[model samples]
Every structure is written in structure tokens, then in C-alpha cells.
Target: MRVSREQVTANREQIVVNAAEQFRRRGFGDVTIADVMKAAGLTHGGFYGYFDSKQALEAAVCERGLAESVAAVDAVRDGEGGEGTAAEAPLRRFVDDYVSARHRDAPEEGCTVAALACDAGRSGPELQQLFVSGITGMAGSLAGLRGQGSAEPAEDGGPDFATLSTMVGAVILSRAVAAADPELSERILAAARERASAPVE
Candidate 1:
């Protein structure tokens, strides 16, 4: 009953994808390897076949989540008439998606940085590095929207890191009280959008 290499790769990817979504929904400490394995439709005994340990799986999950987030931003940029399109078009798309109600309600498929930042502080270095890379990628994406080749300083004094942090922080705050304070949640997103879209000063 040996599996083919293709199937094995699919299984491993499935495990990572599912684990990433679950980790974003539930903190790392709250999720167990057995739980992830069961959710992935594989037996607990087979978990080790794909990942050496839960920590390794966490790292993989973080990697996958971060890649997806950056890809999402890149897709928006690519759609906006290649590199010559107005930077504001991609920037608006990024802000809209980042603070949207759909994103706020969908933790399993949303940005991992906003979903798992608190947990990342207590996690191992692998997950921490993944978080840092994701944040940097996001900042770079926003910087690109400004026609900058890198996340270097803008002549207008707008910092990409500041924009990235503000967006992530807004989402975090929006989600924190979304259930009990729906109006505040909506306002949070709207306010963040307005601020993010304003001219960087």
C-alpha cells in the first residue's frame, strides 16, 4: 500500500494548507497535530510521514500562508495594467481587500499576519521568520504600488512599513470585536481604508 510520489506530494500539501488555515483560525498552542491530521483526512500514525513534528508542520503552514498572502497582493498588481498602471489602483485594491468584511470574517483564508501575530510572538523561530517575511512582502507590495523599485524611503515621507503595520493592526482590531461590536468592526475597516488611501505625509 505504498503511495505514489505525486499522491504523497499532494497529501503533504493538503496537510500544510489545512494546517495553515486552522492555525490562522486557532492559535498554534490551541491546535494539536492529531487534530490537524484528522482534519486532513489522514491517520495520526501517518502524520510523521509528511512532517517530522508539529513544529515543522507549523513552519510549513506559516510558509504557505505567507506565500498566499503575498501572491494575492501580486495578483492585484498584475491585474492593474502591468507595471505602468497608476499605483493608486493597486493600492486601493490592496486596502479594500485587506479591510473588507469578507476578510474580517474569514480567518481561515485571510492574511496570516493579521490572524496569527499574537501567537507568533511565543512560537519558534521558524514561524517568526515566516511572519517577518510575510510582513516584508506586504510592505514591498504596497511600496511597489507607489512606483518604487524597493521599499525604500518615499520622497513624500510615506513609509511602507507604517502602511503595512496600520493595515494589519486595523484588521486585528476589527476582528477582535467583530462578533460583539459589529458597527465598530465596520467603522474600523472604513476608517482604516480612508486613512490608508490618504496621501502619505
Candidate 2:
């Protein structure tokens, strides 16, 4: 059966979206093309029509995952109510959302960086580059938030890389620690949020 170009485009996007969610929920190594195709409600044989190889599908998934994450950060940084919302409001929203237990428990819907950075570390260069770009972009957004509220010229006049790292690290650690020590997990998140909100020197 011949698929219309519009339907083909939609099908391809569906596969990538489903694959991204699966990769975020499970590690990249754990999700197979069959699993992704099944999740997308498509036949396994049709997978090759959209992607030349699993690696190509993975690259597509990586880009989609990173795009989802980047969009979330952008929404927070730009504020939902358009201009005039307090500059600090969006940053606060991001820190709170990013470090919350909800985010920790919901890998499929959360930041890809927190969900898959460790997995990406061992993946191909293209995927790793996507991870790096996602992290860098996120940090840059947070740094811009920090700069708006700082009295000084923002030190080197860039984003606060440490705070952004701390937020991402805290989410990963919190998820790891949550299964064993719930209190500690919450404490970790709280500390990261507090530290992120603190005035930069």
C-alpha cells in the first residue's frame, strides 16, 4: 500500500517520538527497533522505510529528545505570559520543575539530559554531540536567567554552569537514591533548588 507523503511524514515523526520516549524511559541499549515500532503501532518491516539503520533511528530519537528538553527550558526562560513576567519567575519555575520528585519519577516526560546522559556517554559521537549541545543550551539559558538578576556583570558574563550542572546531577542522583533512601532523595533535590536560586557571586 502506498502511503501519502503527509502520512509518511506523520508516521516517521511518530516513530521518532515513541523511540525518544522509550530511550528516555529505558536506556538506549535496552530499546530495540522492534520495540519502538511496536510502541508506534507500526509494523517492524516498515521501520527501514523511515530509517536506514538503528543508528539512524537513534540519531533521530536523540534529536527529538533534545528538542523536547530544549523546548521546555525555552518555555520557562521565555515565560508563559509573554514579556513583563518577572525575570526571576521563569528561572524559579524551571528549578522547581526540574528538581521535583515528579520529574524524577517520570523519565518518559522529563528532561532527556537527566534521563539519558550516562547512557549517551557510551553511545556514538553523533548522539554524544546532541547531548553536549542540549546540556550547553540549557546551561546557557539558566545563565541568562542568572544574569538578569545579578547586580554585577555576571562574573565572566555568562550562565552559571555549576548551578545548571548541579540541577541535572541532583535529578539523576535523586532518582538513583530514591529507591533506597527517599528522604535523602528529597533532600538532594531541595539542596540543588536552593543552591540554584542563591545569588551568584
Candidate 3:
């Protein structure tokens, strides 16, 4: 039977979502089209119907994950407000969520930057571009938060690049060393949480 266009779109989105989860959990090189299809509960042959190539699927995945990450950060903005350290409460909550043991152990649901930046660097231009856009969106959402309180925007009006770097880098380092030294992993998150959530100067 022929499938409806809506069904096809839903199926394609399902495949991308599953692929994103699997790729984040297993890494790009370790995942395959068949694996993504299987994770999506669709037949392997149907993969070509949705995407032209694994890279295409990855681009879609990155798009979805990055958008969600930015949205998650944007959601925190509604919670902004308090005096003193309390003023940083919203971003602090976000930082804690991003740099926690739960996030470290759950790559499939974590930040795309932390999970796939290294792979994207080698994956080719299209994927790299998606990473760039995604990272920019993330930073934009974060930059929006700074505008909420007394902290004025930097001349560039960009996200606090240092804090963004620390947040992503901390997760990456913590995950990288997690298998070898669990203590270090927790400490890494702790240090990053402190820095990433600190009140702006």
C-alpha cells in the first residue's frame, strides 16, 4: 500500500529522532544507517526513502538536537529573577542540568555540542555548518539570559563565550574521562558548574 505524505513525514522525523539518540549515545562512527533504522523500528531498506545519506540524516539530527538545546535554555529565561546570587538562579539551574552525572551518563539526551563536536569537525562541511548554526543558536539563547538582569551585553552582543565554552568543554572532558576515572568526571562537572553558573562580572 502507498503511504500518505503525512505518514512519510512522521516516519522521516521518527528516523531522525532515533538516529540522533543513537548517534549521541554511540558516536557517529560507531552508528550505521541500519542501526538508526532499527532503532527507529523501520526496515533498513526504507532508510534511503527518507535521507540521501548518513550525513544528511546527521545534519537533520543535529538540527533537531541543537534546536531543542536552545529551546531548553530559552525556557530557563522565564525563571530568571532574584537578588544577589539568586539572580543567576535560572542559568545556574541550566548549568547544573547540563553538567550533572545524569547528563554525563545519558548522552542520547544531552547536548549535541558535547556529544558530537569532535565528529562534526571531521564529518564534512555540511555537518560542520549545522554545528556552527546550532552552536550559534545555543549562544544566542544564552546571550538572551544575560540581557534579563543587570549584566549588560558585551560589545559583540554574543553569548558569554567563555561560559558557553566551559559548559560544553566540561561535559566533553567529563565524558571522555568517565570510563577511566569517575571521580575526575564528577569533579570536572563540579568545576564547570561553578564557573558556568558564576555571576557575570
Candidate 4:
């Protein structure tokens, strides 16, 4: 029987969402189209009905993950009074939650930047573009946290690309280190939060 248009659309979205999470958890190179289709509860034969190819789907998944990451940061900022400057409370919360064992153990739901950055180097141009946009969005979110009189230059002096890269790298490395030593993980998390909340000197 032919499936309804709505069902097809829903199925496609399900595939993308599942693929995004899987890619985030297992790196883009490690996940197969069949794996994504199976996780989405659909047959592999029907994969092309949704995506032209796995590359196409990977691009879609990257976009989806990027949006989700930005949304998470947005949620945190919204809860904290929309103040543009990574202050103590929100920054602390982000560092604690992001570097915790929980985030490390759950790669599928973790931050895409930390989960996929290494693999992104091998991705196609389309996927690379998605990473670029995602990084830009993340930097924008971080830049918003600076206070009014900080006198930091926007986009550069502020928590721009380099700063954001450091933050993501720190979280990723902390998670890796945490796997062997719980105490080290806790220390890394605390140190990251302290640094994130500290004023620029």
C-alpha cells in the first residue's frame, strides 16, 4: 500500500532526527545509512525515498544537530534573564552540565560541536558548511554573554571563535579524561566553570 504524504514526511523527519543523534554519538564516519534507517524503525530499502544519499542525509543531520545545540544554549540564556554576558550562573550551569559524566556518557544527546568536530574534517563541503554555521551560532551565543562595559571588541576580543573553540575543546577533553578518573573529571568540570565565569584580565 502507498504511504500517505504526511506519513512520508514524518518518516523522513524521524530518519533525520535519529541520524543526527546517532552521528552526534558515533561520529559521522562510523554511522551507516542502514544503521540510521534501522534506528528510525524503517527498512533500508526505503532510505532513498527520503534522502538522495547518505551524504545528503548527513548534511541534514548536521543542520538538525546544530539547531538543537543552539536551542539548548538559548534555553539557558532565556532562563537567566536574557543578559548578554556569560556570567557566573549560566556559565557555571553550562560547564557543570556539559562536562559532567552524564553528557560524556550520552554522546547522542551531547553537544554536536564536541561530538563531531574531529570527524567534520573529513566531511563533505556541505557538512563542513553546516559546521561553520553551527560554530558561528555558538560564538554568537557566547558573545552575547559579555556585559555592557567590558570594552571587549565584538566578534574578536569577545568570546569569538578562538574562545568558543577552547571551550568546546575543554569539554571534549574533560569528558575523555573523565572516563579514566572520576576525580579528574570533577576537577576539570570545576576548573572549566571557574575559568568560564572568571572576568577577563
Tens-digit lDDT track of model 2 for 1-201 = 889999999999899889888888998889999999999999999999999998888777777777777777777666652233464556666787788999899998888888888988888898899877877777776776665444222357675578778888999999998999999999999999887767766
**Candidate 3: minimum summed lDDT over ten consecutive residues — where?**
80-89
lDDT of 4: 0.73
Winner by lDDT: 3
Error of 1 at 115 (Å): 1.2
Q: Clashing residue pairs in candidate 3, if any?
A: none
Report the C-alpha lDDT of model 1 over 1-201, residue by residue, as the tens digit. 989999999999888878888898988988898888888899989999998889888887788788877887777767742332454466766777787898888888888888888988998787798888888887777766655332234445443777777788899999999989999999999999877755565
Q: What's each prediction's TM-score?
A: 0.87, 0.90, 0.89, 0.84
Q: Please list the residue runs of candidate 1 whose C-alpha ends up more than 4 Å from where it truly belongs after superposition.
A: 80-88, 148-159
Taking every candidate in turn, the Cα RMSD to the unseen true structure, in Å, is 3.7, 2.7, 3.1, 3.5
User: Candidate 2 — worst ten consecutive residues by lDDT sum?
Assistant: 146-155
What would the per-residue lDDT of candidate 4 be over residues 171-200, giving only the tens digit for each residue? 787777776887876677667655654555
Location of the lowest summed lDDT over 10 successive residues in candidate 1? 148-157
Clashes of 3: 0
**Model 1, residue 59: displacement in angstroms?**
0.6
Residue 200 displacement in candidate 1 (angstroms): 0.7
Measured with C-alpha atoms, the lDDT of residue 72 in candidate 1 is 76
Error of 1 at 70 (Å): 1.6
Q: For all candidates, what are the clash counts?
A: 0, 1, 0, 5
